[model samples]
Target: MFTNNFNNFILNTDSYKTSHWLQYPPNTEYVSSYIEARGGNNSFENVLFFGLQAYIKEYLSKPITQSDIDEAKTIFSAHGVPFNEAGWQRLIDKHQGYLPLRIQAVPEGMVIPTGQVLCQVVNTDPEFFWLTSYIETSLLRAIWYPSTVASLSYYCKQLIKAGLEKSADNLDSLPFKLHDFGARGVSSYESSALGGLAHLVNFLGTDTLSAIVAGNRWYGMSEEMSAFSIPAAEHSTMTAWGREYEADAYANMLSQFGEAGKTFAVVSDSYDLWKAIDNIWGGELKEQVKNTGGTLVIRPDSGDPIKVVREALQRLAAKFGTTLNTKGYKILPSYIRLIQGDGINPTSIQKILDAVTSAGFSTENITFGMGGGLLQQINRDTLGWAMKTSSARVDGYWRDVYKDPITSVSKRSKRGRLALVHHQGSYMTVREDELAEQNNILQDVFLNGELLIDDDLTTIRERTKH
Candidate 1:
């Protein structure tokens, strides 16, 4: 079953509504018929989404086959959008066999750099030229959020590296463990899951249920840690409802699920964190954890994390009778780890890591949890992934017209389509928009009616790993 979080966004079989400046004319059969002719399966869901029903009405056909309906319905259901029986029939009638020119983008988790054409679409039929005008907005809607968040995760990895370098001394070892905990801040469940998957390229743990379901469905990773649920407040189960109880609960929880050679993180700022640690892990619980050989992760959710980490380490050393090397060097894997979560951004990470280095505790014992700085704070447009129309010509003149809000370029589009090629060792994004009349290395991805790019996410991820 699909998780409740992503169900609404993916299954939204509503009209392809957009927030762009361009719109197509009503019943413009030329475009609709063109899509229908070239293996385009149009449905009301697509039509409404495209928002071109009035323009494409002239090319409207009878109801599409159950197979087509089922395929779309399945896509929607998996995404968690409730089926809209009320408008299903109407959409089927309007978009049957009308495949809108769809661009098969690189899978969700692939880390694409700035200024790349994440995806693009055009009319399948020559007469349907007008349909291409509407693809930019929705395509970006699909591409931007995940790419941006993934990119943020990538940068965060750099901070982790920096922290490691600064604290090489006095630390045992540190694992690059990053977790996405920004679901509540995301605009929709779909975005949350996509963001989570994208982030996995750099950070593999997440706290969004939708991300777990969607990531496994698309990326073949169901067993991955997608969510971590432990409330900060104590409950009534003999564990009293306060900070002391919370700390004990954390140590006990880790002790209960003892996984040797693995790390289990506990939020330590539920009340007075040092007090909790002294009260719970200090006397007996700490020894139990040490004996079990499982590493404990103390998360600082409030206050100056760097200071907290220093004090926590000091207290641990005093209690355990093991002194921390104040200079540089690894402390060893058996020591506990520290994770910082509150208000962590790229800039803040540098600050905290620098502070921790000055105080002691090698960088190997620290990790970070990033949430808002990525999902809610960054603007997708700033990354600059756009699909522009470049022209190809029967004549020798080649032109590339790129649109910018501030200015228009003189390079006119050559007209036709675009395809990317692998030449030498680098990728050569070419314009099928016009054929060169010479043999080119790139293959036509969507030719006549079939899509040629391999749709598997794993294959793409592996191929681009260099």
Candidate 2:
């Protein structure tokens, strides 16, 4: 809390972002930047536009304020960089403290093919061209990471649903197949909130409290329905009982939450995982678990996910027995299930499902918890996200602009104004002028100071249903 002039900057941005010259062209009278997910190493065929509206409302609505300009002037002058105080002041005076930028984006939750335009940014006023790309740089993290996480979460849901269809009688449990365990693994509270909320668009199970708060605040979700969590235990809780009292720890969990018909999770790997299942849970506490009228989720926190999950399920079934679902697959008893929380990503999740099903168990017996892989273990290139200026109005004439880096062919940028069109049940990128105005999927989400589109979380979730 102490005063430090050195720490005061105009805005919190990347370190390289301090140099303003790096953000814009020398002649930046009017620049148009188009942002897209170019489709890199992701397994999905399409990118989901999920979080742009929230970003626009929270961060981009008011681009620059008088205080921001004054701080920039002070910081830049002290650092011996040319600060455009006049340009910033002009924006504040003319735009009424809002950024004079038009943001056109595909509606949140709509699935658009890779290389299709997700959002486009253009300076509404000719004088603010240099500001467009700078704002894009500031806002890229808001769009790229959330959309990527949403797409990944959506695809993971599809995989889980498919596995459930083959193994379980129905897909009623798909929404809770993958739980968000990424809150602590993310870089910041804001990251956890954004990434957690993105995952919620496809499923509801989450331990990230900030995500629910974000949904209620930004995505128009009521406090009661935004997201949910269940009572769960960590390594500390189980290990705190000491090795000899481990069985008592398992018994205490069931005694607390089992009789009330409430579901809860307990980590089972603090000691010998197999012993906990065989001796403690399956032996001493078996009747308590069966009589609790609630589900006891056993979590395996460490080891090879596929092998550990399959082994844990086999041992649990041996002790608790199994029930044949309507689909003719073997499901565990209603009171017990397995949760694999370690080394769980999209790939490992599929692997675990396959191994468990191959071992004669239904997918319903298992749920997944992903931490870093769901949130922190990604970057802009994960889905090939890029924002490049596609058109610029120079000398009062609009001209197509693009970049074709010799270093990487895939880095080539598009030219002219862009549009996403529905073509043969798929979205396609095309020139804006080539499409009928009504057919263009890109809608004005933010124009000047106004938010044109604010989608609710429920509506966004409904769009993800296939």
Candidate 3:
């Protein structure tokens, strides 16, 4: 979605701008001044420069001139770090130029099956092969989490599609809103944001501001859709002693919202769930809500999710003076939905779908509040993420190799620069090491620090559109 002019920004890989983010204080001024100064003179260092270079060229496209470069030096000198010609020349010699990057995967939102090669990044330059190493953390985090979540999202989609096809009249009426409830469940802020965004691309909702920030910054999803909110309420413990406390809890939850017709989702499994639903919910409140057209979501925190949803829907229907739409034909209640939580994995989710369907509840009238399983269950190791650098020196050949104490096949790193060859629609990793003495035209993605890869998320999305 980035403009063509914006896509032309490229700073040489050796420029201080390239390593700005890696520095302790973050070299924002150097990067900003360099890009503003030498607009057309940008280039990337060795092969690992593809990602950030691509991002700048295809998105920022700021105009830079020699004056900007000199200004950057002035800024550095003012900061007690003198920047000079020799330093610039050393950077140019050591890191200027581009690293070819290759990433292969199923579509971002598509269900990826097991044993797939999620992605691989190979250095295009023999000299700067080490640069490829730093990219693994971010790239793996980016690709792996989404691929796994996409699989689960598709699974949930299938469950809804199947349930809708079974009983509902129009598929369009039931909008499945899958919310990410795992922000606090994960290990770090970065993982929480990225993982939430990945699932949102396939599913529907999230609560993380960081996720929304990333969606707007990277994928252009609007702030409105990304910034959804939910109310907070305190409840008693899941133990038996909470019976005396349950009434006050429900009253307090409703008190905060105050007689409004907005949706209220209360965790219902504390003390006897059936008593809460049958006595408290079904008696005075159900009648009040029925009069006011307010819907109640009985979030089950314990018991089998399949059993809980089945019974909950049955009770809701019975209260409404409606019958189960058996024989795969039924009318859906517009006001009510069976929202569920707790242990919603693929297996548990499948069970809930089946149980609700067998009990004659429209699966479309349900929202899943997924927690740790969706966010933390998927690890980077599952995606087969690897970064291999095959280099081609000034001499005309390539070699691709790696050393591992765990592997038997050439523990020593492969010698030479490598090129990626797409033969018969499959990737054949080729070497550019000097031993072969064969010349193959490399796809010049980076030269003098300019990035050639498409960095716009949509452009990258399109390239995967096979």
Candidate 4:
């Protein structure tokens, strides 16, 4: 959906950012900035770090060319904005079109608490002092989107793990419990690629295929950490048979993909969900579902999440029968299960689980598919993400800088060159100058347009595992 111009870092910032090169102090030589989640509105204490490497590999790794500079010049002039013509020429002439900057960040997939630094940027060359903040538009966006998605996905895992511990047998199904059904619901292809990979960090089930490509291309992953999805029928596939042949549509799904030990899903909400669950699936397809030697997941697409899920589980339990686990919670027989893909979020998921488990059913008897809630339900303010120049060098003098307005104390930002360290088993953002550099947790991942570190999804997943 994008052209090669998408990789041009010169045109990646806001129009106002193009004028900021002229707004700095006359003697400015270097600048340092940091990014963190202030955690005001959302009240999330921790955020999962991700997607920076993908940005670095896709955009920053490439050199800015003459064509990029020409495009930026034309766009900035048309916007009535100041263009850094000489500065652009100098980058191409002196540094071979590479950015003269250094970026240090916490290792990807590690959960760092809000109000702590996750990334820091500094210019390697003093002449390019303004370059640090120039890329904030793209940089902050790159970090926030996937990090927020990963954090949300991570939070859901904690909730599911708690329910599984009390009512389910083992944690084997935890990864597949929350599947990614979010690709079509997001705003763009990049959103799907980024958000899908974030969800993959916590779960192994997904229908967003773009994430698989992103994993292999950006995160250095092969099929080892690839996501899985069962063949599932949507409303069109089911309703295309018309109400008269509704049973035939489900029967076709079993006939085609229902090999031994396989699982397939059919959305059974057309006409009447109860009739599809009771008269059709429970009666006509009962033997096929029971003796097919595989599992059939029943999907209910409409109605209130808690009530609909509880009623569906009860109906399926009565039809197929259930077995009690060691914890005395009833689990659906191995041949059949239920999935609620409609109106799903963490709040609704917990509510549905609470309702079903309260009715003596195990969370293992059902799975959840979250779409927009897992990807598009957030923004920069969701976790209070921001990037500010914490310190700057004026006339070769370095000084701490911060904003502490008397009106809003929550708008306060951190100051000085920062360093992240794990102290007493908890992460802390400290003064890099005051603390030992050897103890710093932030690694130099990018330098002068070169990617210094490459991480695979395997190590990333291990770091994020509960």
Candidate 5:
């Protein structure tokens, strides 16, 4: 379906991009561009390399067919745009429809600092120098958002880990700390799938089904263990029982899923959060909850998350009693816990944890489910992502090329061929020519329409383990 779409094959780039003359300097035969996260959101150092392998497999695995060229020619001609007919024909005749470009990238899932090159691209054939930038326009667009989402998720993990270190006995549950509930909140299925998989790079809990499919299909992960979610109730199911029978509704959920230590979540804020928790849940259904050998995860969907989560923890602790963990923090009874799914993001998550610990509760007493903030509410600027030409070969000489917009100093681009190097316990961006071959961390991830690096989900997940 993607290959047949004429727009998908072409860059669908800026209107000026249609003219080859506008893309390169006179006599330019080859151009090189590097991609980076240029510092934004005060979390630049938290950005991690992810989603490149999946992007390559999904978008660049197949070569451009003859039909693709024909479609491009038709569209350009219809719009009276300057079409590179000779260049297109040459690619068809010599390269057999495959893109003649070399893409080198840091290994997927590596934690790299900001302003360092994440990936570099250059056309192998001099005639296709314009193709390099043109292709990057799409590739960068496809990658930056998911990469940002992954970085945001990783940053959340670091914050949660810190809180857990102080408030929990063990950090083993860190992987399930943040759950992806952003599937419906995102714009499309593709967005949900990509963003959800990105979140999985750092943590394992997810309610996004498409992400699981994406992991299995694109990253060679098994559906059984790639991502997981527990049986849970939503507003419709709980509200259907009516406000008068709210207690019965809670009883039904526990009765159905409460078997042999099974775990489930019930949305408790559909009618009255406090009344339902006190009268219905802690009052009427207390015996049923205690008898069932299962864990009941109470979800407070609406309100100030920090206040609600801490209050829910306190009430649960008071009703069921609490046990002190080895870390000297109070843990909720084995059969009860809290989930705050409202207003969750990296910053808000940290705030909630701070409140939880300050209120004498362990971080393990609650888990988080993020929606728009996790998947849909970010953009390229979230991490200051950009791809710009750093060099070009003209008249048998490789000359550095960069744009230093005087108005915006931060928009300045790098110069010369680039390589990411690990030095002094951190990754640094340096000119490729200056570095010895061994120090370069960038690997050949793609070449001539073939994916050179295929990373698995487990490998990527392990990279964020620390």
Candidate 6:
């Protein structure tokens, strides 16, 4: 759940981090760090800034209690790592246990290009200089994972958008085109919640319910159905009915959830996919499917995605008939559609789209439910995400900090206090001391143990439109 820390900031970081208090420069009072996604792939240049507020609300909002310090001391003492008991005690006594940090960032869900700073942090109290970097382990993890997932989802949207524009009449169904089936595919419930919410930034349909809980608890979306899904059947539900009753199992699905305006999904590849689509769905249940007045999503769980989808669409159209849009692309009946939930990623999706297009069908005839490919296939280095110290103050003097490795110019970090601003129409990372005319887009999000900005999903969703 990622909340097993007992709300303890004292034990949240790496064990080696316990000794950092003794390692800092003498009279070190201030330390500054910034998080960025250095652009590697030209295609993934723009990224959605996300999940900092979740970390802030979940971890940083709570203070380190004396018991936390006591527990941390015991853990570190035996573990041979130095614990800052005095510093933690001072936090409880003087600051009421809140973190002395000033966090600034571009608004959540804004898709800014890479090589720009998305978030920056500095210790508010000089005494807690080590605190800024100490929070890096948690802070960077929060941003990188969700942000990377959101970016992958965003690029998927662009792919679907382009496909729809070329092969469909309108983009009316764009949001629900790519549905999330990644809840069980992730490593943890918290990862599912965080990654699921990330996918929601671009699309509206999902099977991941935990995303809605996170959206409400952290980003303040509607408590009810932050992401929507329809009644869907898995392999177990179909197989439990046995192979002989496969037709009956599908018929029961239609009887149960197939009302007017209510959509439902059923995995159709149980025994024989062609037999299920041809004999069962199109032949036997043809009249019922036409009369249900709701959309029936047929899922193909195995076989070559391109061949399965193209053949399934042709088979469905052979029985049910197809309507042509103004653009003249083949459109399936509103009551019927095809979904490919296996091995779905952008490359496979594009290949399947190419096959669909070649077969004279519109993209409207298809929906995609991506599981692990949508959520777990990415990592921190997927977009070159890093949080690095850019500035530090020692004995009343400030100096820019950075690393310039001769081996890799791309690994070089930024120097000086940073500000994210829009200069000449695009986002840019610049030095705060050197900038004068341009307005900094990075706003104070959290400061001195208090949240400075509270943004809901509605506001964040609107930002993605432009």
Models 1 onward score TM values of: 0.65, 0.94, 0.63, 0.97, 0.96, 0.97
lDDT of 4 by residue, 12-61 (tens): 88888888989988989889999998885764778999999999998888
Lowest summed lDDT over 10 consecutive residues: which window, candidate 5? 1-10
The ten-residue window of minimal lDDT in model 6 covers: 1-10
Residue 113 CA error for candidate 1 (Å)? 4.1
Superposed Cα deviation of residue 285, candidate 3 (Å): 1.1
lDDT of 4 at 100: 89
Tens-digit lDDT track of model 1 for 12-43: 22334221112433333222111110101111
**Candidate 4 TM-score to native:** 0.97
How far residue 148's Cα lies from its native spot in candidate 4, in Å, is: 0.4
Residue range 1-466, candidate 6, lDDT tens digits: 1334555777778888888889988999999999999965536878898898898889888877877888787878878988889999998898988888899999998999899999999998999999988988989999999999998899999999988999998899999999999999899999999999989889998889899888889998643566788899999999999999999999999999999998999999988999998899998998999999899999999999989999999999998899999988998889999999998998998998899999999999999989999899888888999999999999999998899999999999999999988767778899999779878889999998888889888778778877
**Can you write out model 5's per-residue Cα lDDT over 27-126, one digit (the tens) per residue?**
8888999999998857557578788888788777776767676777777777788878678778879988788899998877877778889999998888
Which residue pairs does candidate 4 place in steric collision? Answer: none
Model 2 residue runs over 4 Å out of place are 1-29
Off by more than 4 A, model 5: 1-7, 21-23, 222-224
Clashes of each: 38, 0, 41, 0, 0, 0
Better of 3 and 5 by lDDT: 5
What overall lDDT goes with each candidate model? 0.49, 0.84, 0.49, 0.90, 0.85, 0.90
